[model samples]
Target chain A: MVSALGIQLGVVGAYLLVALAVGLLAYRLTSRDAEDYYLAGRSIGTVVLLFTTFATLLSAFTFFGGPDLAYRAGPEWILVMGVMDGVLFALLWYVVGYKQWLVGKAHGYVTLGEMLGDRFGSKRLRALVAGISLFWLFPYVMLQQMGAGEAIVGLTNGIVPYWAGAAGITVFMIAYVVIAGLRGVAWTDTLQGLFMLGVVWLAVGWVATAAGGPSALSNALATNKPEFLALGGGLYSPQFIISTAITIAFGVAMFPQINQRFFVAKSGAVLKRSFALWPVLVVLLFVPAFILGTWAAGLGISVPEGANVLPVLLNEYTPVWFAALVVAGAMAAMMSSSDSMLLSGSSYFTRDLYRPFVDASLSDAREAWIARIGVALFATLTFVASLFRPGTLIEVGDTAFGGFAQMALPVIIALYWARTTRSGMFAGIVGGQLFYLAHVFVPAFEIAGITVLGGTYLTWDFALWGMVLSALLTLGVSSLTAAAPEENQSRFSEGLRAD
Target chain B: MTRTSIDYLWIVTFAILVTFAVPWFLWGDSRVFAGLPLWLWWHIGWMVLAAVVFHLFTRRAWDRGIVEGGR
Candidate 1:
């Protein structure tokens, strides 16, 4: 490790120095109050809101995983996942996101749990939500760490060890989050988002051009793996149904970071304008990762299973300068997600946990400081998890996504449907979580004449399928029960728009 | 039908047209749509829907008086 990429130690030092600078800046900005720390005093306009939303949702995984999925599972999975993500944002651009931001602003809710608990009149619900957030977010943080390590390794040609990269990323992330709070996160996210767009466009174009263009790559891949061209490749089994897509699409608008994007928007008009441009952003950004992945497969590069595909591919194909930019882009992706999660994580602990339970009398300034420490603590723990777990960060982060999506149907149904009761949301959350866990960890069941797919034996990740069972339980239970208190029911809709 | 129901049907019809009808007609045989890629078509669908939804909002929002709110 000492003689690694062997760039002078100063190179790594500069990265850490920039991170510390960013963190100090954020910490100073946020040291005053929770409002400023948590939501940037709602000062973000359309431009900042647009970039922050874009970067916060994209990470090294979104950039790398598309190509990784293409390389390992064939092309079907990339198309399915990529298209699902696109559809998800489009759906959010419409109905779901508006409801979230409007309701959140009307009541000063920071965490989804806070929003749900306030609406449903249950404090325990808040705790349940915060706990679930911690459960899944830890892995996401770990993924950023893993991505940090992989990016450094690719750039230095394994001159840097995994732990150094992880520690470097962790320090940078913690500093950045503490320095700017939401303000820093938003500005850096905006910069990183724009920077990475250029990086991805160049990488994809270069890869395709080197391989003799898109059609030639398509021809090469067709010869090697024909299913790479199919909607559902051989045994890859792309789940491209309308219902399945609708399920994935609808769930996208509901991610906590995405919902939080709404809370900071200057106005609904700003949000709408940003969302209107989102499709172009989507195509410009993630679609390139997919094209690069397909191009890699065409060039006959045997990409490793679950590796950081974009940087790995870029390192293999492009020049050192471009490769360095890809490395920087990977770090930017890591920082994008980490800063948002740090602010978001601290918000849950401060607003949802501390203020609600142990320290209501604490000054907002003190709470803001506590949030800085909380970011540090969260960063440390997730780093430790990445160190210990090592390989599962990306998938675990995806699993954590289910934590948000599982809550989606109930949240939306409760918001829109008059028949939706507190019990519905509660049952939906609890039942959905249990079903999701069981469908993930438990097995199939065969009783009497009926045989359940995951009931009798433990099976694979049934993310969308789990939501179906959960949704049924929520709706059925709600229909059989009385409605929530009318006061609670009408609070959200009063200030929100269905358009 | 009532106005809201008409709006709902409009969304459903648009969903079907782009999600299926257009795709089936133009790229049913995997041919690109006028040399634009398949993914571009999806992008077009996303952009078109976005334009339509926001256009309707600006045109018919009919908020006689809107309230200023906080976060």
Candidate 2:
């Protein structure tokens, strides 16, 4: 008999080759200019823009980690992604993205640091923002690499080592980004988004139906694991749920990869249309994953604790070919996210750090060259970090999300609030990171099974403390300091009113 | 309708409903509705409501200047 693992890897390898071909095709349409390379010539249409954003936002964490969480905890986890994030993030796109698009278009910005730096009139602040983003982003990029490694190991039953899987993806991503830049990343992301959206639903739907319909699945949980269907169920408390929703919403708003997407949008209407449909897409994709995860419990499918539940479910319920396709689909989600992040991180280093600080007069072609190199360097670093496997994909992703969320207050203040001085923005960012990092790095006490941070008496999540303290410091410092120049305030206010 | 400050109310309402209003009151309720718990459905319901709210919010006058640029 032909090796089933060999056949599965063959199918996955074929899918990856097709993605590479798409990147080359996009290269033909790309221009040689730095703007075109980094921002896709600012010419992305509605459907492509929407799906790229969707695919990039829904990463390996969403595809693999979400199902695992639902299986491990309960259906309450669905509320975290399916319900709150769908709507909350869409609104945040409008509130933050619209402004960013307007300002970026007017100023010809390619990175968030550039925008923040110009608005604050401080190169140090721009470098600081970019540095902070990269610091948080490293773990997030590592999570995707680690997720791909775990997925490949799970799919092939350890025939392929974890290090090989991570290295293969890192090399592929560097090739993709170098071939077509943002345009290539966007085209492939659109294709992968559609693949992930379709394959996940079909595979999960098939599995759930095979394990008896919804009611039967529900009946099994009610009989043996009613707590899985109950409120205050599993690991999520109400405070945990509420705080995560808040953190994720703010986190999505400030992600460097997601933030840079505003600059690639073809027009304001395209961005608007994408945000409007975001929640619908979230519901469609997420509901099935939750159902399938909950159904796994009912079917008594045994998954190793902390391992990805997806490959386990597919192995038992689906055929080899179908499981291969599902694994490929999961890899697609990881690749789409990883490519965008690599591109964004490189742009931060090139546009925000290198051009601004290292060589102010660098030529456009040379800048693009530096950016491609940055992609390779960043991907390699993240790949190296993935080997250590510090945390699970979801845990690593959540830590990054908390850091980004802390920056949201400073970002909003920088944009909408006129009195926000450079000092205020700087202090807000530092104070927030200090508070959040202190909590994250220091071990917390587990008293009676509730995790309490070392200093805080209550069990409230660290993200809440970071955001609240950051916003207060921003406000208090801005009030004490002289306002930004009148010219700057008018410039921002004018951008807000433009229509 | 021409955009006014009031166009933000629905989102404000949406924010409150998801983050504070419903989660505090209804999320801990253990009643099963559909195949999932009541609070889970409440979140789904809020998603639908949020869609409607965002649809209305987007319809309000937004800066059209950015829409008429390079294709």
Candidate 3:
């Protein structure tokens, strides 16, 4: 008879091998062209586009952090992440993503920096955007590796060390990205996405049935942790809920991996269908994890100090093989997200950073080679950072979200408002980043408060203030500066006006 | 692109949906329904409604602002 540890290792190993095989298969279908490598030749169908976007955006945050928050804080996390974000991000997909697709199709643009810099005729702005994106992207990329490490340790009961788990994922991700590019990433993402969804739902069903059904869990919660079933529990305050919702929605819109996807759909119909289905998909995946987490609280599941609640609960309640499969699904989430980030980060480096500043006359083949090298180096750097384990997954994830949220106003203005100038863009991007950083680094400004009813009661999150400042600077600075040339401005607007 | 009534309606509908997505009205109420809290149920219903609204928008008005204009 096989030991439990051996079965777990076997399951996880099998999952990794299948992922590698899928990625290598994608390379055969991929061409040598830069566009084909980075954006899948801009021919992704609705299903592939939807699943890839879903897989890339969900990440370790959704699989691990969502359950952890629900277990600790309550079900209000659903409001912040699931219900609010689902609708808001879908709307942004229509408003921001649709415009980006149109503009990208017209100009053959591959990166956000390329689109913005060309519109304003400023290489510095391109480099600035790329630099900021890459800076925030590091923490998020490290987040996946960190999640992978913790997940493996929890699943294997520490038979696999954290560093080994993190390193294994990092190496596999780099190899997969270098070999397959976006085509492989998307195909694998679809498989991984399906795998994650299936395993999560299965785990939820198996656990809930064993616990005597959904009503029994609710009754157990009502008997034990009644505060979780209600609002105003000091954690999910109105301001906290609203601020988190807004920041995450806008932040997701600016993620380089997600933004690049706006340029990859085969047709407007594909984009329309994908966005329309996005919220439903979000609900499907989120409901299970959060519900299981809340149920765990009532069931008296005791988690170790540093281990994640979801994995711990799974191990205690589910069968060994199913637990391993769920952990593999979590690994799928991490690998899918990390591979996409590295791929998009490479594009930002090659097109925006290296070409304009380092070598303008590089050939496409050389550019592709440089991008692959950049992906490897960047992934290695983040893997090293992940080994440090600076912050919790949610803390690191929130900080990254706040950093990206600063870019949303400037990006929206550049795409829609014709009078947006390079000076304005620079001010908005730099100023918002500074203000956000100040708030993050300095505790006093993280929550600006006012004395109300003889107490310091009214407060707001830093992201709200950061976004407000960004909008003000973008509009104020643009009004005081000369607009981009009329012809250059027309490049963004003409296609929208064609009908 | 020409502004259509569907676009305006979508904006207004989303604004209302967002305002109510949070269960502020259900604050301090601990009523349970169908194995979940009433507030949680509200979010579930709201998400379903949001999806329906998106489906309607895509079928009725997505082409006007994006596909036709982009052409």
Best by DockQ: 3
Global fold similarity of model 1 (TM-score): 0.84
Off by over 4 Å in 2: A29-41, A180-182, A444-457, A484-487, A495-499, B1-8, B16-41, B61-71
Which consecutive 10 residues in model 1 chain A have the weakest lDDT in total? A235-244
Error of 1 at A238 (Å): 4.5
Q: Write the per-residue lDDT of candidate 2 for residues A16-72, one digit (tens) a residue.
A: 878788767766655453345454457777987788788865687777777777877
What stretches of model 1 exceed 4 Å from their correct place?
A1-40, A235-251, A304-306, A388-394, A442-461, A483-487, A495-499, B17-71
Q: What tens digits encode model 3's per-residue C-alpha lDDT throughout A1-499?
A: 2498899889888888777887777656554433464644677788878988989656877788788888888888887886446888888898789889888888888889999988988888889999999999999999898888888877777777889888988888887776665446777787788888888899888988888888898999999899998865757778788887888889988989989898888888898888778777887888887888888898988776556678778887898888888887778667877888888888898889998999999998898789888888988999999988888888889889989999998899888788888889999999999988876675452224643222012467877788989998999999999875532876678754221
Share of native interface contacts present in candidate 2: 0.39
Q: Which docking category, incorrect, acceptable, medium or high, applies to candidate 2? A: acceptable
Q: What DockQ does candidate 1 score?
A: 0.20
Which of the two candidates, 1 or 2, achieves a greater lDDT against the reference? Answer: 2
Ranking by lDDT: 3, 2, 1
Candidate 3 whole-model C-alpha lDDT, 0 to 1: 0.81
lDDT score, residue A44, model 1?
A: 65
lDDT of each: 0.63, 0.75, 0.81
